[model samples]
Target: MTVAQLSPQSQVAALPQTWDLERRHQSMRRLVDVVQQLSLARSLEAIMDIVRVAARELTGADGATFVLRDRDQCYYAEEYAIQPLWKGQRFPLTACVSGWAMMSRQAAVIPDVFDDPRVPADAYRPTFVKSMAMVPIRTEAPIGAIGTYWAVHHEPGQDELTLLQALANTTSVAMENVRVWSELEDRVDQRTRELDAANRELESFSYSISHDLRAPLRAIQGFCQIYLEDHGDTVPVEGRPILETVVSNTERMSALIEDLLRFSKLSRQPLERHTVSLDDLVRRIVSAQRAAAEPGREIDVAVGPLGQCEGDSSLLEQVLVNLISNAFKFTRGRTPARIEIGRRSDGDEPVWFVRDNGAGFDMRYAGRLFGVFQRLHSAEAFEGTGVGLSIVQRIVQRHGGQIRAESAPGEGATFSFTLGQGS
Candidate 1:
């Protein structure tokens, strides 16, 4: 990281046998360090800060100017100098040496600024600059220039010119990288805003639908209940079955509406994270299921070493309740309906699962398992609102996790989930 050292008398030293090689090596090291810094530069200000200092140190220049093209003008944006030159000034592109370098797409080497007609003599009269070398920032369709100045008449060597151009080339690439990243950030921000607006609209629509639909459904249920209670004997024997059918359908419809509302509400629910013991949770749910089981319906449930996780206790409990309940329902009529709750490792992820040896579904329809109101088994065979898995999936996803199912007809089904970061 050593910088090239020049004699106090001259900024650009002659090729002396004593220290020519050593100085060149130091300059190369400095260039490498500057290139590394430019790679991480995310803005124009950062690029200019690195380039301005490196330009003076690399060439032993008395001063340096970082010029940027502003349409047909050359802007003296930044500078590192012993004396002020043009720190914040603008001039016509055709009137400045840096502009000429950009326009010609080559380095401009002037040994005497006063003698050169292209050099603005009026500007240099006030500064200590007697000679200068300017290189375009980009060779093809140049965007700017880097200029190094000397107090005395001195001509730059091929090595100095080459190093300066290399810096400019790297600067071009760095600017392009900054532009690409800025555009990407803008696009991501725009998409995020759009998604937020859509989610808000959907929440409003779902709530409206829930309220509007539930009122009529409650009315129907109330009228059916009154008819069954007060007018049961008045109805003929054949009409009694029809009346019962109407009541059953109304109850099923109410269950479906409740489940639908629950599924919709889950999307907007804020998760409250807490440490949860899967073993305790599963045992409690299984105990309740056992207590609720019909008399003489022998059921055997095994609780395995289910681990713990960080998640919403209420939402996660709902997940387990729905999964375990489905296992209990599907395993009905078995000699001893068996259900197992356990944990397993899939690669680096820990998966928790609820398994049943009851009636499993075909694997081909597995994709539809988490969809609302989608069911493989009919309501008559296995009664359900069919929104359980969808709600389970929403909760798991809110915990930054995923849920999946595997099953084969008459072989049983296993539902597994992972609570990624929460785990």
Candidate 2:
């Protein structure tokens, strides 16, 4: 019932002090136990049960009910009366006392239900409820209400009202926590399903490349080689050049497909991390590059002490191979191409770098450097599939690292990266 509707005599009628000091002390101890249990409750149903029992015990009431707001209805979701009273009942927001308490955002203490005009008399006719006290679960915007009832006309005092309000406040927090945790679990499940679907699609694509694409490429390359060797003299000299061009293009296509497959595989490959000597890995790549260089080409490579890092050894080796090879490819015209491999600290983490005197790119287009099949120079000037940097970036990212480059047109470039503490 609204406070304004109460008669002057009933409003100030003092409630009898039935609870002694010892009874109040026992109530306080029970309230503390209920609060502790509320924190471990995982569901709204469980929280409601705890609140229902706690409210009855703390206020020495004959019955207690937990009411939740459901749109335009007040739902008696749970009840703990000595004899059942509206255990699974629902009423219109305007017709129920619980709804009125929530709508007014205040507690209702009715000493005599039959004397109050706001009481729905017919609903209590079959039950023994003669009085009730209801406080909204939340103060500012009530989501629900906690109610206590008596079988006889009994006035509830200020202490009993205060105890019920504290229990309602704790119930609100527990319910909100359960809702937020449920939402987070649902989001995690959705993301996991999405990742599973994407992986299946990728596996299908990879299978198609390995079988369908490779079959046609292998046939073309084999036929071209047979034709050039078996019947070279039968064709006109001018026409022979066209046949050679076709063979070269087919080889380049095969190389491009292989690089694409490697790039795709990186996403699914699990990292096998361990301590790797960066200095040793760089030296091995440089040795391989020098052995494959043209006879007259001269290149000066300086390998310094690169501190060890924890990462997948094979993947780290591939990163060094790609960066060093790019340096060699871009510095084709330099009489004595200079390349340096070293590492230095950046206060928090060690930053390893590959510096080269080569054909550096414009800083404006550096954003596109790590994209697959993106190239700054034409094929005629420098031949490449342009998938190397993309692969390097993915490997570094998988290791929880960051990579960036500094460069300008005509000036040389430096690529640096940091791999965080190992997982």
Candidate 3:
């Protein structure tokens, strides 16, 4: 063949093939961009907006509709088109091409709407759509459909159909992700509301106990003191012991009320955190305890390098006071009460501990150790309001820390704790 004649024939054949390849390549590139956008979409509305524009551009279609299956009806929720086809409209599942695609769980290609038995002729007669293609959003169980329309009689190429289906599949995942996120947000909101309500109730209860209950308790204690000081000698010998019992109980009641008030205040107070030399704090508390100790009592205290920690100084001091005070109170009968205060090495975190060779408790009761008003020993064995350990626990938790106790009967007790970053 002559060069000129061969060139004409070759050019004619190569031109269409090259054009088709370029079109497919552009469609795929656009699909990639659409997929990226869909992945970030947090709402169904966002997904709809993305798919509407991409569907028409990827297929070179004149119009595209984002359809959702509303029960047995196909709802045209959104659209992007040269001319409006169905922006807000509904049709029976059997009567609409989009609905048919979702119901059958496959893509439907129609070269001519009038020639297809599935498409309602009356519906297409007033519209510009002649040829159309619809793909289900999901393959196994379809939720919706993506429909592309052409004004002229045309059959979509296999490449275009594949790209459209790919877009549809991605849309399904995006929609599911949006649903899951929305549900999670709702659960968090509900939990927050519940916590707020519970906190408000606790505050009200604390206030009532502080005022209403304390006034009467104060009156009882005051009267008992007056009776003891003014009329003590007049009472019969046998009645004197009963009168003393009333005075003793009033003092105990006052102490319990004070402990309760302190416990309540701990929850409302905000933490004033800073770097604190725990060694100094522990020593100061122990010094005060020693000064208040019985004149002849002997206490052997072993203080180690407690080091520095991030925490509220006053609150941390209270924790140490409660633990050390409990040690002194429990080891009353010991010849020389032994108490140890120090920090031990822990992986990536600091662990502080208080140990005492005191009248220790059983390990089985350890779970109840931090609960309010939970005492392992009888009132005669240990004189305490039982709110001290509970207060210690609350302070540790507020500082982003955890407190645990370990002990057995006759063995020393150890209270160990860890503080998080804020602590």
Top-scoring candidate (TM-score): 1
Higher lDDT: candidate 1 or 2?
Answer: 1
- Compose the digit string of candidate 3's lDDT tens values, residues 1-423: 433465777978777777888888888889999999999999999999999999999999999999998999999999998888878998899888887888788899999999999899998898899999999999987999999999999899898899999999999999999999999989999998999789778866876776677778778878877887899888889988887788788788778878888888887888898999998888888999899888898899999998898889999889889988888788788778898888886777888888888888999878889988899999998888889999999988988988998887887788898777654
Find the number of clashing residue pairs for candidate 3. 0
lDDT of 1 by residue, 8-46 (tens): 445434446447888889999999999899999888899
**Per-residue lDDT for 78-131 in model 2, tens only?**
999988998788999899899899999999999988888778988888888999
Model 1 residue 376 lDDT?
93
**What stretches of model 3 exceed 4 Å from their correct place?**
1-100, 103-105, 110-133, 139-142, 147-181, 184-188
Taken over the whole model, the C-alpha lDDT of each candidate is: 0.89, 0.88, 0.88
Shift of residue 182 alpha carbon in model 3, Å: 3.7
**Clash pairs (backbone) in predicted model 2:** none
Q: Tell me each candidate's TM-score.
A: 0.85, 0.69, 0.74
Q: RMSD per prediction, one decimal?
A: 4.9, 8.6, 6.0
Poorly placed runs, candidate 1 (over 4 Å): 1-41, 53-63, 80-88, 125-130, 150-154
Cα misplacement distance, residue 286 of candidate 3 (Å): 1.6
